[model samples]
Target: MGKKTTHKFKAEVSQLLDILVHSLYTNKEIFLRELISNASDALEKARFKGQAEGAEDTVAPEIRIACDADAGTLTITDTGVGMTRDELMRNIGTIAHSGTAELTRLAGEGKESLDALIGRFGVGFYSVYMVADEVEVTTRSIEPDAKPVVWTSDGRTDYKLQELDEDLPRGTKIVVRLKEDLASQFTNAAHLKHIVNKHSNFINFPIYVGDERVNTIQALWREPKFQITSEQYAEFYKFLTFDPDDPFDTLHTSVDAPVQFNALMFIPKHGDDPFGMGRENRGLDLYVRRVLIEKQNKDLLPEYLGFVKGVVDTEDLPLNISRETLQDNILMRKISSTLVKQVLDHLAKMAKDDADRYADFWRAHGELFKAGYMDFLNKDKFAGLVRFHSSGLEDEKGLTSFADYITRAKEDQKEIYYAYGPSREALNLSPHLEVFRRKGVEVLYLFEPIDEFVMDALSEFDGWSLVSAEHADPAKLDKFESLEAEDKPEPLSDTEKPVLDKLLARMKDALGDAVTEVKASARLSRSPVCLANPDGNVTSSMDKIMRVMSKDSSIPKKILEVNPDHPLVRNMLTILERDENDPFIEQAANQLYESALLLEGYLTDPHALVGRVQDLLTKSSGWYVASEK
Candidate 1:
């Protein structure tokens, strides 16, 4: 038989219903998930009780949602341990809480927002008002005196309850009458599927929307590290990043510190996360218990580490919420800091135990390591982990640690000479390395892009300045070249002096606004000329990137230093001797300037350089020569 009836809610119950309806502002839609959460909690409790009594759990352990879009109703039924009449009255009606009256008063005065207060007092079930105009709960108890009970509420001022005789075995069924305006959310199959995936992808049981269980993820982060194999971890990493490439490293840690947490973090084999773009980044995920929380949590780690891909689980999280904005919360901040350090420690361990593997990682992510060296917060730790290919030492397999670099510092090497370019071969071939090699100093070969930034940030390492190889001055040259060598083998001749003066004057005019001065060489030994920044603010590469990025046309000024002893400079000196009024002088000067610019790693416009070379050929090949004889 069936009957319909109504009864007035208790005074507390009416106020509770009011708060539940309007309290949750932004998180209103969570009412469905909250109800599902409570249902799961009930089922878990029931399962625990059954386990305690040593009885087999025969009920299929899953939560299912059936939608009737045409009927304008959605029923969320669970085969969980159902509630009896008194359980409903006490759990649902009275609003189980200790500070219920105070919260109700605080909420009614509108002084406090309802979102925070909703699930705090078992009002998770009331979230239905966020979407539904009315809800009816039909449940049957497992108790001997159990009977089917119906509790109905419009989610406003009051609710009603009644008993009925039916064959609803032993579970809870909640039928929601969608608000007329929002009925489409329940009716459309896709929307229901989206909601299930977004919020409850890893519920303890199969979460069926319509007919099929939408959640298939095993929530593998919760598994014990010993139980998980390398293949399993790699599989999960690929699934997390969608990268067929296996991870280079994995770190799984469970901490119950200032805040409790279980984190499984990995650094992918490739040093970048491909977000469909060619650009690289860190890919780290955050979860709570077995449910995925935030798929991409950037704040937990720094950007240079964008290559990290993994999951973190914490019990402290309400798990019933949005983790996008988790970093601001105190709990998340602790987890973020702790997890980053844990991964770093793992990397350090790799360096100590597996040099070959760590070298592979270094070869790929050396830029990121250098970036960490630049960031003030991560510097000390990242610096210790930096590995580089050294020039003085043999390049076999292992990377040269900065500690080893310190041990190899020269007797009079005032600072650590470092050459940062595209490669060890390139830096070694550079004109900039002449003085360092002449001085018999071991310059650290830095090929990574972030190396310059790290050296600039570090400034000094192990009490020695990080001197760029290109920087002017072979300062402490006593070890190789003595102070007596500053004396020229021969003085600047009176005849050559006038040529130098004229050459400098014409250069100042031709390269106006592009060079501070065209000085005679002092630092140059083998090269004809070299360029240096007068101000020496940022690195040349960074300056060029800035000029191009900003599309600025203003040419940066540079100081030009000629090697007085070089064969090219001597040839130019000889040419100037014949031509005080030489028409080819301008072409000769341009060629020398362009050559210096190329050596300095600055961009020299190719068209003008080609024209200058063509003019040189025209003059040398008798094309512009008057009477070749």
Candidate 2:
């Protein structure tokens, strides 16, 4: 046996211990996590040194944990590059060289770099004091002739170092005598296995709790992409996400400079709710050097990507002392920004290379992607992922993106036209689309109520303003001639214009506040009448959405357009010119306006419309009897 020396802890070491034992009371269970992480780090260093020295796997690297319920003790053993006597005394009893105090002071000052330095300072070993009253460490160096040493500390003020009586193996072992109150909490084999698997499951070396081995699965994210198989990837994804369906997409990448990170992310075949879920917090698991630091870490990704499931292992993340939360937010943002870009880039590639698969993904996740419409920083990129039912397509099976719309737009089409309705079928049948259909101009159909907000968020795509078809003026389509109507029809006769004007004015008077302005229709080639929003005003779809949201009963006014060529309107004009007060004339005019209101999806109370239709039928019966007699 060699001489035993008792040494006092550096002032900073004492101060740090004081905080761990008393001031910092949370995450006491993290002591196991910290110790396991330290063991893993030591194992990693030993493996690297063994490779450098051309040592041929002297002893298989592993970590073993044994819990002694009767003895009230927990011991962790690691076959790592053990430290020498001088190294142990300097590393355990002193903190001058590491300057943990300066790091703490700098952390208080909000110095970003010092936060990372603190993580690398190796002060995590002291966290054992949180659970144990006394700790003993026995170690022997890998050097052939170095003597073994034992270090003992109560983690209060000072520690003792002494040489072991006999030679020991090239590794370190720590035995912790738990406090009486804390003994029952941690001495169980099951609880220790849970902690080991929770935090250290990805450690490079095998970990054994008693005789059984834990941490069986490899950290595939840290491995090169080429080395993993599709079946393995699927299994890993199932393990991480508990999802049975194969992932629609996978993004595996490793970044070196600026930030060091390895990410293996998966987009599930379907999400929990593709539509809005009301700001639910969700994100990926975060790990540092194979040890999990935060599970479900929301800071690693924005809420827009909550549906994504995967793991992000980075060596550069600066963690707090407990490794529970991140320390440097600015650094986190940099990593997050890079991750977001990579994910988007991978999606863009999928969109470009695989239309069928991408379409499937889009059909499931398109609405969620719309949530990113307000993310100005990524709006342009996100726009490429937007899909909508288009008038140009015969069926709704295929969806068109804004980029596709721009490519197919007419040369003089100054605006990107879209129409919002409750469903694709409603938007398809909307009378507002008459002019576009006549002129062969395509209009995008938006179905969801939130689609309006999404369009407003994007505002414009490729320098072309997004104009709702319901709100578009007939004049906008004047540039494109109606392809079917090559020869224009005769205009309304000069003398008949007076009668048409009187009929329009009378119809406007009958409708009262409902009609903003009554005018001849240039848009309608088939329908008798239709309602449209006045120029520079909200579309009927927008009005309906607002009314429903606010629970308001009042409906907004819309311009009334009359097709003079239609037989119904011609008959009404004749009645107005002959006898403006004719009861049937008023009934016909009112019916015409109500039908337009119904078509616009704004007429909620059907009683008034039903009553008017019955009156018109009764009057028609009276007219038919008179004619038959």
Candidate 3:
């Protein structure tokens, strides 16, 4: 051995080493990932240089990992371009000095494949200290006349470097003496293989642990779309998500503008948490040059798109020293913007090409996808993808998109109407739908409580306001001729108008503050009464959801609109005229108010409603028996 020299680590490097050994990474196994990534980078550099120099190399590039359980030591060796004495001093002696980054800078545009290099921060090698008491690096450069060098360090204040007289192969080898507490965990070959498979399985180079080859999986996302087969995609999806069923659809995309990244995303056949019991773990596995940097990185996609799964590998992202967290959020947002666009574009194509398959996707993910209404930046795309069951459809299972609804809308229609109910059958019975049914207009049916929030967030689409059927303007609806041909029931005669007015006053008095207003409803044709939000500050569905969340059971006050032409309303007017203090008129009025509340899902007590129905039934039955006798 040549004369040895002792050198102190950079002041900042010493501080960084302390952090790396203690708390820089949440998982101790991350040390293995970082070291493997560095090795991959070096191999890539060597391959790029060989291509540039037109050199015919004979050796195959690979990484080898060996464990000595009894000795409590693990060794990793790579057949890649190694470092010289001066190069080692510059790369390892200083902090945050990346050889890969320097080579890229020096090569500039001459080396196109240098983008595959992974290590951007020089601190990755020091992470070995996280699991090792001491590290030894023995390397021989490919440069002619370059002697082998040995670097020894305890990862503390100082390290020793010496030149070796003997010739060695052109590559790098690192041996780690495991710390006492962590020795058993890392010294076994099986455990080391598991670590290699978890983090570096997709690395371009082959990896070996003893006689067995690990990292057998390919980075299929980096391959061209035309070269990949359907079977391969399905197999890869299963491996990535562990979902037994095939994916509903796959979105394999490569973007170049704004940022460059390759992504393989899948829309699962069914959501992992369809009921949303708790916050689901979401986001894609983020990779940098095929090395796993962050798993389930929520920052890569918005919460609404959490149902999507797969991997995203980008060279544009800047990682902090630990590589566990992202250094720049702006680049992440750019990548996210591109991803959202790609996903929406794929769905749009499916919707246009295969209606049945698109419908299946809607059924599987619509509940969660509807939340994308808040993504206003992609509002047009989101609107094009939303599907709803409409009054025009024959059944609840039938679906239509907003674009289709607009196409079917009447020429004079300016607002897209929707209504909320517990079910389609219940909505058919809604008093609020009488006018919409009469006008031959379609109304979207909102079943889930979140549907109300989605519509409210959207408010409008394709220049048409999304107005609730219950909140439709009476005057605008009157412009459309009634499609119903049979209408013989005359409105209250001119002389009886005063009686109707008195009945309205009496009913208002009976309901008291339960109603904001009680007036004749011109929009009603079949039902006697219906409720409306006077201020329109909150939709009835949202009101109920808020009430449930806040634990408030009181019914919300709303306007009560009575149809004058209905038989029940006409009879109530006669009863009020005969006896202004009649108890039956007050009871009937209260019953109508409670019935309307039930339709709005706000009625807290059904006992009073049940008793009123029974009272009316008893009186009617008694009259029927007397007539029969």
Query: Number of clashes in every candidate structure?
Result: 6, 0, 0
lDDT of 2 at 473: 60
Best by lDDT: 3
Computed on alpha carbons, the lDDT of every model, listed in order, comes to 0.71, 0.80, 0.84
- 61-113 per-residue lDDT for model 2 (tens digits): 99999999899999999999888998898778865456666746744654333
Candidate 3 backbone collisions, by pair? none
Quote the lDDT for 524 in model 1. 61
Candidate 3 Cα outliers beyond 4 Å, as residue runs = 22-26, 96-121, 319-327
Q: Estimate each model's TM-score.
A: 0.79, 0.89, 0.93
Q: Candidate 2, which segments miss by more than 4 Å at Cα? A: 23-26, 94-122, 274-281, 319-328, 483-490, 535-537, 547-553, 584-594, 622-629
* Predicted candidate 3 versus true structure: per-residue lDDT over 1-629, tens digit per residue: 79999999876667556655555344678778878887898899889989999998776899999989888889999988999999999898885554444443534534322112223344667778888889999998878898999999999989999999997998899999999988999988888899998889999999999989998888999999999998888999999888998887888999887989999999999877766762457789998889887778887777778889999999876532223235356777789888988888899999999978999988887888888888999988988899999999986688998888989999888899998888899988888888899888899999988889888888899899999987888898888888968474775688899888888898999999999889988888888998877787677777789889999988788899989989888888878778899999889999999988877777778999999999999999999999999
lDDT digits (tens) for residues 191-253 of candidate 1: 887777766676787888878988887777677789989998888777677788888888888
Candidate 3 whole-model C-alpha lDDT, 0 to 1: 0.84
Collision count of model 1: 6
